[model samples]
Target: MGSCKDEDRNEINCLFVHGPIIIGAGPSGLAVAACLQENGVPSLILERSDCIASLWQQKTYDRLKLHLPKQFCQLPFLNFPKNFPKYPTKHQFVSYMESYAKHFSIEPKFKQSVLGAEFDNLTGFWMVKTQDFQYFSRWLIVATGENAEPVIPEIHGIEKFQGPVMHTSVYKSGSEFQKQRVLVVGCGNSGMEVSLDLCRYNASPHMVVRNSVHILPREMFGVSTFSVAMALLKWLPLGLVDKFLLMVANFTLGNTDRLGLRRPKTGPIELKNATGKSPVLDVGALSQIKAGKIKVVEGVKEITKNGAKFMDGQEREFDSIILATGYKSNVPSWLKGENGLYAVGFTRRGLLGTSSDAVKIARDVADQWSMINKIFPDIDTKLLK
Candidate 1:
């Protein structure tokens, strides 16, 4: 609300936020800011990256698309363009994100990497320290979603590999690996899609299936599997819904076990609810696997000079390696929540959950804002600006 130099350090800049200070300018932060604006509550957004939705804009492959239907992925109080496909492309989704920020006037402080945020008991405010400024606010919102940072697991002798090895975050296209023997280490959605893309680019991709996973068709009976599951969940129980889904998957995609992909003991939806592991929605990858265009292999034991050694004692030579190990939240590393601090979008329920959290946080903050104004009528209104 106001800017002043820190008394102890005159060169350091400090600002007090009137409302909540939201971290991350991703979909989660934008949604929360828009909802707060709707409630007549202003917010300050701090982003480490220069643009909104940096993960989608900077870290995704060209072929990436929303795995679920548009409705499931959209933010609060806004709908995806009707012109866009059911599952919008990465570029299209990024464009929509930009439009959402513009429509809500949610301009965040870009490149403001937060060093740490702590609740100050003395002043009854949150002190957020960034690289250039110190921010104080009564409310703090951690909007950094689950995928704030990529998970890079250590592999034995990976540094000794003669070929280029990269994570999915830095991977863009399979054209770079054309005619090369590529080893994809992961069986998640990104891994599946990356392997398929490699096949399309005439690259030989061997996908490693390290663990049991649920593979479901993206669409079943001309309807989105996610939509069907949501509808079924209205009346049927989760266990029953999982059974129906598995039965249909078996009839449609055949047994994945024969292709080295084993089904997990826990049902798909139940497993997702328990652990945040999402079931892979096959997008032509299964067909390629069946046709021998994409080879499915076992877990990697170690990385060799040329390629990798599998846990099953098989050795293969690869020109490149792609790790689709996925991402996780970095909240624990920065903010320590207490007092007025809150966290949204870390529920593992995706965008739909984010929308819900945004609305709830806005309402709570609005109530507090109103009460503070009513009780402390003589307090400086400029301080609460």
Candidate 2:
């Protein structure tokens, strides 16, 4: 209901005087909005893309499924369909996100590409400028998430290689690479799964796993490993939980090092909690590897006309390379000033932490908005007059 043209005609755009303004309409953003709404605080969500969760709809490969089970991935104040599987497919999760938005009745303004934002000391509110509009609010929440941008690491001779190179974000299935020897780089979840997808299609996939990583079965003894580890993490010390995970990994995956699946110097849970690096939640990748369908190699030293040089001083030819390198968190980029701005879903705790933080922030806003107004006193100046 606001226009940049009208704001330009004057000095300020006051048409949007909602409670809090949230950028990005993904699950995290929607969580923040829903939580605030429950507290009777309305929030305006500005999404740059056409639909919510555009990343999942556009970027995720077809063979992808949630590394965690569905019970562990539900948004706050919402639940996945009862009929949904434990570990839902990527498409199923996407559809669940859509239904979550609907159930919460959260309406996010689409295509509102934010150029930048600034806090006005005089008004004690945020002025978020998009390409075509300016939305003002008492608070600004940035929940664009860690994977808002895809990161492709620089490999030597990568540019000179004369074959198709793309990120796993652009990959859908292995059918396109059929009968072609494809190299899947990085040992992250995407890398493992993408290589498996290629194997299923008989694409002859080879993986470049540079370092040791802790891999676990998605389910052990008919129970999700995540459920057990998370329960342990909640009750036990971090160190104890970390060790428990290591033991579980050892028993289940069993000497991944022998298969070139080396363990990182950092323990699995320790690595994930300390930094945001994701560990593999193996569905069928390991079985495919053990079956000799997916071959593993070391890091890429360089690229050639029709091949890649490995760290072991061996060269292997490939038709293409898919970098599943992963993503980086970046909500801070939107803020020209940090005052009155909050970011969630960047803590690397994945969906659970993201959803929890949204609820926490929403409750904080509901409890303290009046205090913030009194301290700043600008709330009176722009009290929806």
Candidate 3:
């Protein structure tokens, strides 16, 4: 990569990357970098945080585990350790990600948050500006993925609530909330898991189920639910697969509506494909709900001083509020893809999608690299110097 000084004497370094400049050092970015390296292409990864997979390293709760089997969650070039369980813990997954990076000799520049990125029409390159440096590259890979930022829903009168209100991103454990009545907003996987964790800590948690959801048993008949679905999908149509899944789920987990968790009219897979909303895979929360340890509540109408008033006109008191509201992609806030800019990990299909996208991106970039090299021999040696 070439470097130059600006005329303003500001000492702001400008770098011209020979290969793609990847943003975010999450699993997606790491996977792309590894694939590119295997394809005999170099890549520069920029991480906003100090460590790789900042979402897993810093934001996630302690008890979080891979919702899918380890095989499905593994990156493009490396596999999870043989000793690891089918569902690896959060720490174990992070460790595996670290090993994957090391195996590929991928060293990312940490704390280089991209302020903005745009395709420079005149230069035919991507101009990515960070807090400290300006990067110009032929290829730009946005691996920041979805869930780059936590989504805190706007609750009416939330400011009026006297209790400590926080998002699940900052939540670590329920041990600190022992014996406290906690109100968890949202009915997604995180919300369910958090409520389960709270119950384990002897904390009374009331989870808000605002909308219809699909909760499936993590496994069925000794096989993963996802695996079963995939196996069925190969032979049956999508609607048939959904019907089969719902049938099995009903038989396995019983009718969740009786417990206040209503099923959506749209099939889980269909809904997911359409909206990127994942069906909740039960890890132990349903049992807690059935046992009456975790109470289910309706949507909040307004946050009161001690708790919240529900949409059903019921009010409840709680010591704290945990917003398991989920996360969203911050891509549109900073990136304007036009020319050679590519985005991976936003497919909402999770790690499987990430791995698939990473390989495609690497191959595409490699093909262009080869074509450019053939057209301009010694281009890297002379121009990149």
CA lDDT scores, all candidates in order: 0.93, 0.84, 0.92
lDDT pick, better of 1 and 2: 1
lDDT for each residue of candidate 2 in 1-385, tens digit (9 for 90 to 100): 5334443475444456558989898888988998988887888899989999988998999977788888778998889999988889989999998998899888888998888888878767688888767777878899899898889898999988889999988999899998899999988888888998998888988999987788987776788888888777778988888787778778977889899998887877789878777779897889888988899998889999898999999999999989988887566676777677788887888888988899899988987775765686565445544
Q: Determine which window of 10 residues in candidate 1 has minimal summed lDDT.
A: 376-385
* Model 3 global lDDT (CA atoms, 0 to 1): 0.92
Q: Show where candidate 2 strays beyond 4 Å.
A: 1-14, 370-385
- For model 1, the superposed segments whose C-alpha errors exceed 4 Å read 1-10, 377-385
lDDT of each residue in 269-373, candidate 3, tens digit only: 999999999999999999999999999998899999988899999998889999999998898888886788888899999999999999999999999998998
Assess every candidate by TM-score.
0.96, 0.92, 0.97
- On a 0 to 100 scale, what is the lDDT of residue 18 in model 2? 54
lDDT of 1 by residue, 1-385 (tens): 4455554656667787778999999999999999999998999999999999999999999999999999999998899999999999999999999999999999999999998999877678888988789998889999988998999989999999999999999999999999999999999999999999999999999999999999999999999999999999999999999999999999999999999999999999999999989999999999999999999999999999999999999999999999999998898888775999888898889988999999999999999988987898545344434
Error of 3 at 281 (Å): 0.4
Task: Report how far off residue 337 is in candidate 2 (Å).
Answer: 2.3
